[model samples]
Target: MLKHSDIWRAIDRLAHRHGLSASGLAKRGGLDPTTFNKSKRMTPDGKLRWPSTESIAKVLEATGSSFTDFVAMTGEEGDGTGGGAGMSAAAMRRVPVIGYAQAGNDGYFDDAGYPAGNGWDELEFPHVADDHAYALEVSGDSMEPVYRDGDIIIVSPAASVRRGDRVVVRTRDGEVMAKQLARQTANRLELVSLNRSHPDRSLPMADVAWIARIMWASQ
Candidate 1:
């Protein structure tokens, strides 16, 4: 059976493969731009809203994908969670997400900064090779101007961090902050705050618990 979420995930994967948003895919298919949007995937009363066959046909034509191709993407198995359902090799990924404040707490992450316990809400996003990639939902305006409150920022612990790149850094004192790397050395790290209203941070490397590069953020 094709689960509703699986079909939507397939549509999202299809759009991603073609470098388009779901709305962009719909517009290319001659449908309303919001046809495949996440909001349209469910009704206001929280009812499932499956995509119409005609819309699927139009999208297939727009992207030059066969019905078989679409079905393959759908996986026809389950939600892309357990048993690797709705998988297209690595086109769909489910990552853990928790609030920024919660992430600062212990037990959520291991010493290496990888997701540790099951205290996260899973969210499906575009293909990401890093299995340790997770997202932190911003809680306050401290990271404003660049990442506002409620923004979900994708962080990759496996991704390399460099100077001038935005990163999520945790301190030995259990403080979590998102800032740009001004400098990093064997003994110290210099960070520039995203919001100029906040002061820049310079910390000894020993005081740094772990740091992961911010890969993407929901706008």
Candidate 2:
């Protein structure tokens, strides 16, 4: 009988074949860059967490592989080449992808375009506006208890980041991070870190790359 670990191992092999780590494979698939990160493969309690079919399909597409190839990769003998019951390779392929550091930023990304970087991991996500997808990496413990270092944040580029919404933004100097938007107006943006250890920060609109509202995190 097939096991969850078996499927995980197959995905690991697929990543290795592409000269990438498991996390890298997820990036290639347009999922959250941390989707395949070892830290995320298990729960905080230390139990294994299986990759969703949506994530698998996304990985296949990002790597330019087919459903049949994925099935072969899974090593599930006699299981038809079509995707399993959870997700279809075709549907997962169509979702947008983004890099971790690039999440939450706005102007820097375009719906019809891709972020500039090779470091990313894949994730399964619902279909959204072409312009509304991206990812970001946790830089500090500012969002602690909720988001930690190395956590990947998925943001919807098209979604409006309102006050209290966790958003990603980059300064003109390229300091990118995820913070809750406390206030926004024509002139400035005020942000509060989820972690009380870090003080709130504010910046002018001109200093930002682009801001996107965060939708989910791999925590």
- TM-score for each model: 0.63, 0.56
lDDT score, candidate 1: 0.80
lDDT of 2 at 83: 39
Predicted model with the maximum TM-score: 1
- Give the per-residue lDDT of model 1 (tens digit) for 1-219: 888977887887676555455655676687986687667889999999999999999999987988877777776564333445545646768777667877889888899989888835456676788999987777678988887654567899999998889999999888999999999999999999999999999999999999999998865
TM-score of 1: 0.63
Which structure among the candidates has the greatest lDDT? 1
